[model samples]
Target: MELRQMRYFVGVAEELHFGRAAERLYISTPTLSQQIKQLEREVGTTLLIRHSRGVELTPAGQVFLARARETIQAAGLALKDTRRAAGLDEPVLRLGLLNGVPGWLPAALEQLAADRYPSSTVTLAAGTTVDQVRMLSSGEIDLGLVRTPLTLPVATTSEHLADEELGVLLAATHPLAERTELTLDDLAGLELIWIQRAAAPEFYDDALKRLGDQIRLSDISMSHSQLHSALRVRRGAISLGSCRAATPDVVWRPITGRPLVAKYAAIWRTDSHNPVLRSMTVSPGLTAVRQQVVAD
Candidate 1:
C-alpha cells in the first residue's frame, strides 16, 4: 500500500528471518513484523510462513518482492531524470542554419567542437532568417545562423558571424556567363528569378533597389534548388546567391564594386543558458559582436 511497506516486505522476503531483516533495515524486530503484517492484511494474502528453522516465503510473497525491487529502481531513475532536466546535466545545443550559409560557418562550428564544449552535441536545422527568428522566439532552437537586416522578436538577440559577397547565378550558356565579373548594367533587361520577399524581406528589398527597374524581376518565388533548376533550364534568367554556393551547372560571378553583401549573424534567445552557445558567440572565426540592429 505504501513505499515504506514495500521496502519492509522486500527486506523480510530477501532475508527470510524477522531478526535479520530488522537488523538490515536498522529497525526493531517487533516494528518490522508489525508492518509486514499490516502489508499482508492490506494485500489480503499470506506473504510469509514461519517455520521452527528460519522462515520461507509464500508464492504470493515472491511475486510481490520482484515488483517491489523494480519499483524502487524505477523511483531512483525518475529522480535522476528530473535532476538532468533541471540543467543539472550536459546540455544539447539546437542550432538552426539558413539556406546558403557560407562555407566557413561549418568550419567555425568544427572549431567550436574541438576548442570548447567537446562534450556538447550540436544539431543543425535548415531555415530562413524569418523561420530562424520564429523558432528562437518559440524556444524550438537554441541558436541560428541567419541573414541580417530583419525584424527579430523582442526576446531574441543576434551577433555577426560572417559576411559574403553576393554573386549572380546564370546559365552556363548565357552570354554574360563568359565574363569573369558582372555589373548591374550587364544584367539589365534580363529576367530575374527572385526568392519570396517574406523569406528575407530586407535582403530582397535591397536587391530590388540595387538592380533598379531596368531588370525584369519575376514574381514567382523559388527555393535554392528550384532556382538552380530554373537557371539551368531557362534562358536569359539569373538569380542571386552566395558566391560559395555550389552550382557546377551555372556560373557564379561576383558583382562589380561589391554593391551587395550578404551578412550573417548568430541569433538566439536572450534567456538561453546553454554554455556552449556562450562560447560559440565569441569564437574568433565567427567574429562575435555585441547584439545590435544590423544596418543594410
Candidate 2:
C-alpha cells in the first residue's frame, strides 16, 4: 500500500531470514516481523511461510516481490529527478544557443547558469535553431535557443526570449537597399535569393511559409554555410534573414507592412528523462535579453 511497506517486503523477501532482513534494513527483528505480517494482511494474502530454519515466499509473495522491486526502482528514479530539478543533486547543464545570440546576453546567462549550478558545467553552442532543436531532441544537448515561427512538435517546451525581426538583405547599389525601410508589397514581385532548406531548415521553411507561393524559391549550395550565393551574384537579388544576421556586406530593409518578427525562444524536449537538463531555469535572462534588444 505504501512505498515503505513495499521496500520492507522486498528486503525481507530477499534475505529470507527475519534477523538478516532487519539487519539489512537497520530495524529490529521483531519490527521487521511485525511489518511483514502487516503487509501480508494488507495484501489479503499470505506472503511467506515462516519456519525456524528460514523463510520461504508463498506463490503470492513471489509475484508481489517482483512487482514491489519495480515500483521501488521507479519511485527512486522519480525522486532523483525531482531533486535534480530543485538543483539539490544534478549533473552539468548542456546549453545550446543560436550562432548570433545578442552580445548583451552572455553575462546574464553565465550568472544564471553558474549561480544555480555551482557543481555543474554549462556548455554553450552556436548554431542554427534547427540544429539546436535536433540536438535537444536527440539528447545531445539539454537546451536550445530557437527562432520561431517554429513548427516543431508540442513535445518541446518553448519560452519566448526575444523577438528578432526578419529583414531583407541586399547590396548597397540595389534600389531598396539604401532605404532604411521597405514595405511588404515592395517585395511582392522581386527576384528573391534566399537560403534553401539546407542552409537552415527551420528558418528557411518558416520563411517560405510566410512568403507564400507567389515568390520563387531558389537554392544555396551549402547547408551550413551562411552565405547566400544568389544574393552575392546579382545586385538586385534579395534574401530573408534575421536582423541579427545583418552584416557589413549587406544592408537590411524593413518589410513595410508585415514587419515580420522572429521570436527567439529557449526550447527543451518535454519527454526527456535527463534529470539535470529538466532542471534548467529560463527566467530573468530571457527578460534581460529582450530588454537589451529593446534598448538597442
Which candidate wins on TM-score?
1
The count of backbone overlaps in candidate 2 is: 2
Model 1 stretches astray by more than 4 angstroms: 1-85, 246-248, 282-296
Task: For candidate 2, give the lDDT of residue 31.
Answer: 89
For model 2, the superposed segments whose C-alpha errors exceed 4 Å read: 1-90, 100-108, 151-155, 198-203, 212-214, 221-225, 228-230, 271-279, 282-296
Q: How accurate is candidate 1 locally (lDDT)?
A: 0.77
Q: Which 10 residues in a row give candidate 1 its minimum summed lDDT?
A: 287-296
Report the C-alpha lDDT of model 1 over 216-243, residue by residue, as the tens digit.
8876779776788888768679888876
Best by lDDT: 1
**What does candidate 2's lDDT look like per residue over 223-257, in tens digits?**
32444545667766677665655667677777766
Worst 10 residues of 2 by lDDT: 218-227
**How many clashing pairs does model 1 include?**
0
- Candidate 2: lDDT of 240? 69
Cα RMSD of all models vs. native, in order, equals: 18.5, 17.5
